[model samples]
Target chain A: MVPTNIKNFDTLVVGGGIAGLQAALDLGDQGYKVAIVEKDASIGGKMIRLSKVFPTLDCASCITTPKMSAASHHENITLFTYCDLTSLNHEGQGIKALITQKPRYVDPIKCIGCRQCEYICPVHVSDAEQGDFSARKAISIPFSTAIPQLPILDVEHCMLCGQCEKTCPTHAIDYFQKPEEFIIQAKTAVITTGFDLLPVKNNFQYGNGHIPNVIDSMQMERILAPHGPYNRVLRPSDGMEPDSIAYVQCAGSRDKSMGVPYCSRVCCMYAIKQAMLLSGSLPLADIIIYYMDIRAFGKGYEQFYQNAKAMGIEFVKAKVARIDKGENGSAIVRYENQDGSGIATADHDLVVLSMGMIPGWDPRSICPVSKDSDQFITSIKPKISPVLTNMAGLFVAGVAAGPKDIVDTITESGSAAMEAAKFMSNSHMEN
Target chain B: MKNPDNDKEKEAKKAAMKTLRAQRKDLIASASSRMKTQKKDIKAIKEFLKGKKATIPDIAEGIDMPKDETLWYIATMKKYGQIVEAEKEGAFFNYSLNEPEKTQEKEEV
Candidate 1:
């Protein structure tokens, strides 16, 4: 239900990802009332799923959780997770937004994340926590370290057995719970919805999106991660010991022949990181990487790449022409060698693609105001400012603004916050 | 006691910025002094930074330049051995005039 008080917030941030969280934090720190509306059950967004960020080599949760916790706990910021903006009406003074907070069937304020309901939950579902490499209890925290510590019931898989509802310590579970709709009043809104990974084709000749051995770059990160499914590297298809791995760069980027033509900036280093981490797992495992160019331009990133090569990770300087699933469950990679000699094939037990960033929003919607060829929001003006978008009160940051490293993303996000606040201040003064 | 490291960081950032602006100023001045360096260019920046050496980012407040047509013009100069890359100290890059002999290329051109 819409709050009867209808508190007039100074700014409303949509999407609740890193960009929105940073924007809200900056505004809130300036003593402005801010609201972050998140479609997910919690914030952190895509960054949460990442194993580790580049350059600094920090854990994703270590860097992001503080911001998430701050956003949730801030007195000046109200976090509405599991929510989406349904409708928006301009109030002349500000925007009147209707938000739908989908019921997790758990009262957020009272329920401590004690995991009582999960123990009794009868249903089993794919654990998005494990990147769907494993299953999880229906009533479960998104992960062990999720901010707000609230659990979400997998409503689709739930049988409404009501066993979990009966067992809750705080009586927080309610199967009949309806989505609470509310109106938010804010002078400006920012979209920080974050991004989704592209689906790999089943027909990929590379070991497998189809075969167990072929993994996406994200999955490789997870496997190499200390927190990933199976602390040891195990080929899921047969659970047999497989030796070799190959990383194919520009899996879906910079190829107009396919849909995406722009470079995925994060892929080069991430592939290297994955390769290095994989080497740590199998000291004897032969690792090979194929690429257009090793763009390790970020600070310390070049060092990381060199470290990988020094650790015996084979760096093949060639664009992979194709992959053929070979006999004995191995895959063959055919590519021209660096010296442009005769093309040769190399066999591998697994293949990993270094996929690039793709925006979640359709191009036609957020265009003209912030349009560009790469589908990211163009900076407000070409050279004057780097973070501001065309929309007066709104700003873009991170990959949403344009391709950038993690430090650049945060830096731009901070600048966007200042720009948004200045826009608010000037508008308020004008009013 | 003052944190000398912080002070040095602030100083380096300013110097790098000054060097960059001075180079850009040369670009705009070369293009058309009558048009005036747009608020966004390096020449306007040097004028803005006159006498102030160590300004914090919060303190470095002024309107930025609008575009880089003049800056791009200098990029052509870079290709033809006119402009050169200065030492990269940290986050910022510094640019400066070479020796008088190199600067005299404009006279011949």
Candidate 2:
């Protein structure tokens, strides 16, 4: 009896993003005992970050809000949002997962999302909501409309200041909060730990960390958002309204010599969108896009590209060779307008590297599966099975499986959820 | 204005009007029931719509209403006529229903 916190469940979904949320909903509807463990303090993942999703420009928040509510209120779902899956060990007729929950200090049961603590906390850090667009106090809301309507104290940034502890009318602050660990016994596990944007730290040739005006595709989204810092186009370095913005497509994808080899499906379109948004947001701004191929594949995507062109967003089919610092807080982006053509340089007030999806670094690091050349979890094995790993009773979905859009991710998620459920059902029969 | 044939036409017109009235009554009844629903039920509608399509058969099965009645009410509420768009298969019937505008009218206490 190794302190068996063995709570019983049929299927365990790791990750509380849309894919995980979808899987849990499907399984729970099928009358199976299901649970979700989210590493974040709240559920909605990168989808929440998006201003609007494509193929249909429906507001992302509008779509995700209901799913978030459903997850929070599901009958069969036992959601542990601020928990991490540390280890997966085989146990009684199934697998047992060691889950570690970070302390919010505020008891979710007792803590009414009253923002007294958020305003009082003096320890400020980079606002993740702003995508490091600006800094915020440690206890602030993750976003303006974060689900659960609660605040999390960043223990790393908190400094144990006791300033917040004294101000709580609800007495919600407990600086001595301990990490709670429990074992959830499940017949099968589905991993939807989703993607991370490949970092700009490594690729210095594109100005990388060397230039402040350069941003990632997600950061561009945040900047373009009405809620974001500056709420419009302002170069990070000078705080001046940018005149020219250059987009370097496939910064992390389709470059085997530097980053992942696959052409990240979303980058080209996101670049186009950001360009269109930039031109729309600032009518006079000059926007130039450097790309290998303009991959506007989905329905109405080509029209969006054409719209961008009509709006004076210049599209040059080229591979950016380098981005270096320029005069007056601008950056110089050099590229061949077409393959191996004569090189030319364009100076811009700001530049954006359209980043690509990388596999969940830590969770994928924890699981027993081989990664691909792109670091995405392998979809098919030598045994002719999709999403099969060396380990049994484990599956992956969303960008974890490979590069996919939101719709395909949900469909694949249903399949993954079913496969995990099948393992659970079979295990139950055997037991 | 006429004799037996006119009387028969009047009777058929009355019957068609009767059907319309019955369907409209059902639609009104559906609104009343939806009004009594909690905020959670409205929330549940969003979640339920994703998985359960609220198809004519499913609605009939769920509320234990006749399929014809369910179809009639749904069609009237949707402002679409009885849809023959997708032919009914063995167990599933593919039909389109316009989502009724959720009225804010109050119900009895």
Candidate 3:
């Protein structure tokens, strides 16, 4: 028999990114009880980490934070941050999900977001929230705008230090905290799990992340952010303001050797956006983008590309073959100019690779959702409704279905929510 | 006067902490060693910038550390308010140790 302690909800949203937040808010505002299970401690996901969106140059946080706040503050929504979905299966007319809440080592109820423990902690480690470009206390909130505003203790580096314990006003520190498991029974489910970048270490042609000043697109975003590690655009290798910068497009995409054959649709535009931001910040610097093809297919995208070109940003139609370390913390780009120039090598103060995107989660063993050739969730009726998955009452949206931009992800999220609501309504009618 | 049950609970907690520390002895020792090395490196950089602002490459050469590693330490220090960015020198910005009074003010906050 099913446990009586199971929490019942009308809809369950997985992954708490912008897509998940949108779906949850859409259903919750309709008066349906919605539950959001996020793997990370925060719900803003990759969109929040970005500096600005493409074409509009609007602040990414400005657009994402309000949605995140709405989802968190919504009366019908329940947020399960820092959770792992053990299994999600069809149960009777509803879906049953087993979830494990990871230990924060700090009591959620007792934590007042005072940050007293963080201030007192002496151990400093690489802050992954800042792309490891800065330091954070052994116990710290993930970032300044983390939704929960609770600090997580890094047990590996904690050293059993009692400073935080002594300093915490609420006595929230608990060294013996263990993972808690729970179950959620919902009438419908939506998968909005986003994408992760292809690891730089896997591509040997790009120096396997060994060459300094050769960073990925996300790291460049953090550098461009207002509250970034350096608060300025300086190369990580030597803290130098680069006089010349280069962007290598299709670094991992369209390459069968990397097991990612599809073009990551966002890389070209993002590289151009970063180049424009860099040009604005460093007016005297030379910015070059090496690309086989520039895919500006979105609305106002072509005009954005033209604007970048008019802003003195050079677009070189070339295929970057490899990158090597250069003198004084520089990167040498070796590429074949598509203009019939045989081969050439150029040394740049910094090089940013527009890495490909891969599926963020694998639902094979956990959930029996079918995946397409690219490993994204397969949409059964893509032409009619791209949100409909093979499993009944299980809809997929955003990059979880395929590679898409923020605008498309948001639009698809709403569609998924509508489909889920319709499924629940039909199920109720049949009952 | 403390209750007997409370005293017993306190003893049990202390014993448990002792066992936990013993289990994590190796990790603690290694982390401590790393912290010590990091402190020494930061000290070397601070000493190099005692009375003068220096660029990352200049300090790396001065302290005989790799440029990349030196930059990491410098960036961390700058974030924690130990150092401040100075005037731009060519392609690099010179960094200097924060004033003693200013560091104390930051600590107080």
Using Cα atoms, each model's DockQ against the true complex is 0.01, 0.01, 0.66
DockQ, prediction 3: 0.66
Model 3, total clashes: 0
> Model 1, A378: alpha-carbon shift in Å?
2.7
Tens digit of per-residue lDDT, candidate 1, span A59-159: 88888888998898899998888886776555675666777778887887768888878866644455655555554666788776676688887655554
A268-382, model 2: which lDDT tens digit per residue?
Answer: 7778777877777678888888888888887788988888788889888888888888886788888887855689998988899987777764545455666776677766662
Chain A alone, TM-score for each of the models?
Answer: 0.91, 0.92, 0.98
What is the Cα-based lDDT of residue A158 in candidate 3? Answer: 80
Chain B TM, per prediction:
0.31, 0.33, 0.81
Fnat per model, in the order given? 0.00, 0.00, 0.65
Judging by lDDT against the true structure, name the best candidate. Answer: 3
Candidate 3 segments whose C-alpha is farther than 4 A from its true place: A1-5, B100-109
Query: What TM-score did chain B of candidate 1 earn?
Result: 0.31
Ranking by lDDT: 3, 2, 1
Q: Model 2's CAPRI class? A: incorrect
- Count: clashes, candidate 1: 6
Candidate 3 lDDT, A217-265, residue by residue in tens: 9999999998888889999988889999999999999999998999999
Error of 1 at A110 (Å): 3.7
Give lDDT: candidate 1, residue B66: 20
Candidate topping TM-score: 3
